[model samples]
Target: MSFDGRLLSGISVLAAVVQSRNFARAADVLGITASGVSRAIGRLEERVGVRLLDRTTRSMVLTDEGRLFYEQVAPLLFGIEEAAVSASGAGGVARGRLRVDIDPYFLRSQLSGRLGGFLRAHPELTLELVTRDHVGDLVTDGIDVAVRFGEPVVASAIARKLMETRVLTVASPGYLKKHGRPVHPSDIAGHHCIQFFDPVTRRPFDWEFHRGRKVLPVATLSRLYVSDVGTMVNECLAGTGIAQVLAIRIQPLLESGRLIDLFPDWSGETFPLYALYPSRNHQPAKVRAFVDFVSKVIREPPAHR
Candidate 1:
């Protein structure tokens, strides 16, 4: 109910501990002694009248109540930090740590090559990329923004639509040489297609082709099933099977003739990429900087050499 001096200090220390997962490390972050950090948490727990954390010599974990408390507390803490940063940056310059949650494939395939330029431009900014199979709790994980391809899952967060990438069906030259390219959507059933899973279904995405108002669904023969985007691309490159992937991800390979679009005419299917933040209001400057950078990258892809 109130931001008393001790309560605010305790909250900051608690957030640091949860993030770093160790008292000594948290103390280093807070610039306080480990014993001080301990006393602060003890006071916070006593003030809250619940056990927030259970600690042993080797590890410290959030208790059930602690987890619930953190779910509510972390967002408030993030908002306070964002407010401080906004007020501090009168010139609107982006600074401080900007942690982003993104998928591994997006990181390696899209941002990894261009990140050096971003870092060089904002010398004061500290960027942390947390690559996950699924989006984590933005506030609890201390993530500033989550850029991913799919629907936004966090209902309370602000969602910004970046761009839609086309779904493409591709195969290697060697595979085409051996099995021949499918001339029609129906022909896909006879080819050795590489199956990539749908995260929601935990099964291979159904093969679908679209052209104008027409849609065709094919039951294809998949020789192998892959759980990862990188694996699907690698296997396709090795001429194992045909793969369905986002065009943005395989643009270079397509330009190099390493991968051929099997159904270029049927590339009407697309997926949305969204940038999600913890709150709709009070967005920090650092968050805006990264999101703008992402949009620029998507709009102007690197030319394939």
Candidate 2:
């Protein structure tokens, strides 16, 4: 069959089924009945002269042909969606779904309070927040924006610097009293240190510190290793060991005297936080509004020390 004669609707239906992995679930997502969905897939297979799906009483599975078809058409569907969003008249109101990927710690500590205000400003917009430490493909994952710490290596998206993150090495006051605070970077090797395991690297992250005009690295004698920053903070609060975390995330603990900054003379490197999106041109209203709000929040001067 000619491409012009092919039904894009059938392609979309097939894609939804493959993505959702169930005919009923796909139907619910596409606002159609399960039988209707099955008919659409049947018609699609007939037109293409290929069996696209393997169906059983319990579940639906995509055949090899279906997988290949989905891979080829998903990108085209995404492009069409983007084009439609771009052509939409935004007016002064933000509408439609705004999908965002962000780190859990940053979202909870920084963005949580501000999100209420943002939602109030754009009542028509629906927010879908995905909290994860690892970065994901915005296009393939159908994410509208991503808030990430440090630098992003992905060249496909447009990355805008949101803010600079200040990191600090800290421990609970009790832990410090028991283990004795390290006066210098080299002294850390003598103490029981908390190690942060990078999820992406699957290895322990090196401890970073500053000494006068030079940078110092400390190899830790890890008593505890954790992947989540929240858990690391909790461990430090419970007097487990010293941890390196974003200063903002631990500011309240520091102020409350529950956590003490170790080696006051040394500070870790400042990492850039960025907001990445699929493209700058023809951005959707919801995405544009979110980026603007987030940027404004980041631009606000840090509180006086």
Candidate 3:
């Protein structure tokens, strides 16, 4: 029997089941149903004219012939994956599911509205956006790319600096009008400051201010504290209090006059945003496409411009 496309597909399914040691685990990785995996394996066994697996109710074992076949097939499958990625990246037609882990604040402010445009640009691509306050283990999470605020600490992955984003101290115009505006960072102590806490640290983030060469970290007293960035924006808009947040998200509000910059002269703290992936050696087309798209978005000015 000549090796054709159907045989190759069967071999791939068999290899996944053997490597994962379970149909369910293999299905998860392949993004297929467990029954589909079982059917594929059954077809493969029939085509090969051998019972590759010694199947019991509780578990399965690769037969001697199956073991030999697996040893030969697994490497070829991996090579195929590498080749596919290389071709896809070079062809610039990004397809397949692009799983991304993002900082929640960044999502709320920067990417939420703009995601639809990216998907429309590449109709063959599917996007999975996972957001949280704390950084997760990329391998365990099956994340293709991770977008994070501040510097990344993943030594194994390739980290690309997307941008250095400034932190802005801002308040709603109504809130500022009612409570009055502060000219200096020190003057914020008298206002109702809405605070955000780091998810991993569980401590309030200190407001950062820059004046010439000196960087100042101020711990302002706050009656309102929130864990989510969206909530902080809402509270500020509702005239609940002043908030210090990333400037990227608040640019529209700033331009529309919904929020007023608290200390423009002292805005100095810049945080690094990183796009992280498994390795730089053979980056997947979907991941590379997403990184390039996001970089373009960040570099472009707000709609007001």
Among the numbered candidates, top lDDT falls to 1
* Candidate 2 global CA lDDT score: 0.78
Q: How many Å off is the CA of 272 in candidate 1?
A: 1.3
Error of 2 at 51 (Å): 10
Answer with 1 or 2, whichever has the higher TM-score: 1
Better of 1 and 2 by lDDT: 1
TM-score pick, better of 1 and 3: 1
Listed in order, each prediction's TM-score against the native is: 0.88, 0.76, 0.74
lDDT of 3: 0.80
Tens digits of per-residue lDDT, candidate 2, 184-239, equal 77888887778888788889887888756789887888868888888888988998
Error of 3 at 265 (Å): 0.5
What is each predicted model's overall lDDT from 0 to 1? Answer: 0.84, 0.78, 0.80
lDDT of 2 at 214: 83
Residue 288 miss distance in model 3 (angstroms): 0.9
Sort by TM-score, top down from the best: 1, 2, 3
> What does candidate 1's lDDT look like per residue over 9-76, in tens digits?
88888888887778998899889998999999999999889998898766688887877787677767
Query: What lDDT is reached at residue 54 by model 3?
Result: 78
**Model 3: per-residue Cα lDDT over 1-305, one tens digit each:** 76589889999878667645678888997899988988998999999998887766566678878766765665576467768766666455778777799887777666777888899998999898888776665643556789988777766567889999788899998997798888789888778899988777788888778978998877688988788888999899999998988888789888889988878888887878998875335566677889998888888878822
Quote model 2's TM-score.
0.76
